[model samples]
Target: MIAQTLSQLRQLKLTGMASALQTQQEQPGPYEGLSFAERLQLLVDQENQERQQRKQERLIRTAQFKLKAHAQGIDYQHPRGLQQSQMAALLQCDWIRKAQNLLLTGPCGSGKTYLACALGHQACLKEYSVRYVRLSRLILALTQAKADGSYGKLLKNLASFDLLIIDDWGLEPLKAATRNDLMEIMDDRHDQSATAILSQLPTDQWYQSIGDNTLADAILDRLMHNAHRINLKGESMRKKLNSLTQAEHLG
Candidate 1:
């Protein structure tokens, strides 16, 4: 009867429950004393746990994060201006639910991208969809999408993600077409979805990079509205890591 039940569970795609039941049969000493209701509850709990794990894996896989980072991996020990309390609040993902934004700014190699990716990983763990794209590549892709006549479709797809991470922001000047495309993307997400912008340039210089008075104001207005800002200040994390590696080799 147990074998038949296991077969039926496999057929029904309750693999977690099936596996748990098999374990119960193989090692019945622990479960033998339990009531039928208690055993059934165990099976259900196992299935729920397996489902949650699968969902988290799927979210992380689809995120396409640049770094294998997580909330726990953040370096608070460094003097990077990162507040643990602030990060704790952000990790709760309330800002994402409220369709707010996050701005990460620092000098090159100061771990802005790493911190952004870490937060993004936390969002995925909470089952939120995420996408990481460099600003220049995003602009190039948007231009190609326009030529291929999928611009609107692409915009819709971009707007649907729970969190959109734009890295290397303000790296170069934006032309008229690029500015318009950015406006479209930002307008679609404004008050509808969350965005994370990682940049080496300070927030104040973002205006100069945009180069168009009217469009820059419009873009920054949408992006900065209710945005949480993190300005990391420290020696380059990359350089520090490289130095440590060299020291280890010498030792």
Candidate 2:
């Protein structure tokens, strides 16, 4: 009777531990009654699976990119310091409420892209949608999309993300079409979602770099307003790294 009750409970699956407690729940006759150790092992395996699934879900929620961070020498332990006000503004911006924007300007390797990427990474972890694209690639895609008649669709898709990181601006001057497309993106996301931009050019030169005094000014107007600007002033990281390597070789 005891065995029957246990078997019936296992079959009915009323208890969560049915796999370990009930012999019939596991296998055919002889094998089913075989070993308690086997059942315990299976329970452990199930627990591990659940834990892994949770970890995967957490990663998905964060929407972080291993690539962008890795390339930028971004490590949690070695974050650079901005002023207290700047840090607070970046972390607790009106973007959380109304979805504004962030503009990062500095010489190369002053951590502009690193900070932009970090903010986008933060938004992703908070479960907000995100997209990170290099300015070169973004312009290329926009140009190609226009040629392919997919321009509107692309903008629509971009409009949906909670945050966008446009990295590596000022590497090259923009053409008229590219400038127009950039304005469209700024227009669409303005007051709707946040944008994080990393630019090597200063604000004053943006008009010339963007290739139109009027359009460039318009873009800046939309971007600079209600946005937090972080100006990173430091020596070139590339030159610093090269000097270090050269010194090591000599030693």
Report the number of the highest-lDDT candidate. Answer: 1
Candidate 2 Cα outliers beyond 4 Å, as residue runs:
1-81, 92-96, 239-251
| TM-score per candidate | 0.94, 0.67
Q: Could you tell me how far off, in angstroms, the CA of residue 99 lies in candidate 1 after the best superposition?
A: 1.1
Q: Which pairs in model 1 have colliding backbones?
A: none
Quantify all predictions' global Cα lDDT against the true fold. Answer: 0.92, 0.70
Which tens-of-lDDT digit does each residue in 164-212 have in candidate 2? 8788887897888888889999999888888877888876777788888
List runs of model 1 lying over 4 Å from the truth: 244-251
**Among these predicted structures, which one has the highest TM-score?**
1
Cand. 2 Cα-lDDT: 0.70
Instruction: Report the C-alpha lDDT of model 1 over 178-201, residue by residue, as the tens digit.
Output: 999999999999999999999999
Between which residue pairs do clashes occur in model 2? Answer: 62-124, 62-125
